[model samples]
Target: MIEVRAPEPGDLETIGREAREEWVRDRFRTGVDFSPLMDKPNTHVALIDGQPVAAGGFIDRGNGNAIAWSVLGRVDERHFVGLVRAFRKYMKATPYRWIEAHCIATFHQSHRWVKCLGFVPVNGERCFTPDGREFRKYVFRNHNGS
Candidate 1:
């Protein structure tokens, strides 16, 4: 069984390992540095059989908007999909004007995941991380904000 909950510090050990596995699978050009947002009010961990397999959260960007992000750990890919869906529903409940996610332009699965979470791509738009890694930005806004 999978559970989604606000994460505690102890969960980092497993979450970090899972993140390494994800980087290997995704082949991130600049590589990903896994950092759990446990100290943040809007973070969560996805666990299976009592072990964390993924973590994510949104950071308030102020003015009722936020930026979303997630890291999927090494686990049964079949189950991680459920984790993503659960996280999506949880984020939608937040009273934010809009929530956006940034994904590597080459990360096809991330593009798909955001789409499943109801995020539409900001077509023709692109951005770079502080490290200069390019990304595609996606935004999610319920009909109320749409």
Candidate 2:
């Protein structure tokens, strides 16, 4: 069974490594770093058979809202749904009135998943790749207090 829980300090290295791998595979970019957010109190990890497979976090932007980001691999929909439900509850308990996610257009699965979760597209534009190639930037937002 896959479980979603608060991230621990010891999980930082593993999460960062997986994130870097995903980054390289998805964007053809290496040397990417996630140290800035690892071990942050707001981050969470998804564990399957006791191994970390996905991770994400939120930044409290004040004003009863927060900006959120997540990284996922090919995972089961059941697990993903559970994580979203948990995160929704987390948002409600905190001061956050909204949660936002920015995704690369190349990640079609991600875009579909976010839309399924009721995240409305607020805006989109071209984002430059490391090699100067342009990709679409999709911004999704979920309002909670409404």
Top TM-score prediction, candidate number: 1
For model 1, how does the per-residue alpha-carbon lDDT over 1-146 read when each residue is reduced to its tens digit? Answer: 88888887656555665564456445333445444356778788888988888777888888788898776667686785687678877787776778899988877877877887889889888799788889999998855432
Residue 45 lDDT in model 1? 83
**What CA root-mean-square deviation does each model show from the true structure?**
3.9, 4.1
> Local error of candidate 2 at 135, Å?
7.1
Error of 2 at 97 (Å): 0.8
Give the RMSD in angstroms, all C-alphas superposed, for model 1: 3.9
The candidate that wins on lDDT is 1
List residue ranges in candidate 2 displaced over 4 A: 9-31, 123-146
Q: What TM-score against the true fold does each predicted structure earn?
A: 0.80, 0.65
Question: Per-residue CA lDDT of candidate 2, range 10-106, in tens?
Answer: 4545544555346535431344556566655677777877877667777767765666666655455567677666555554454456676655666
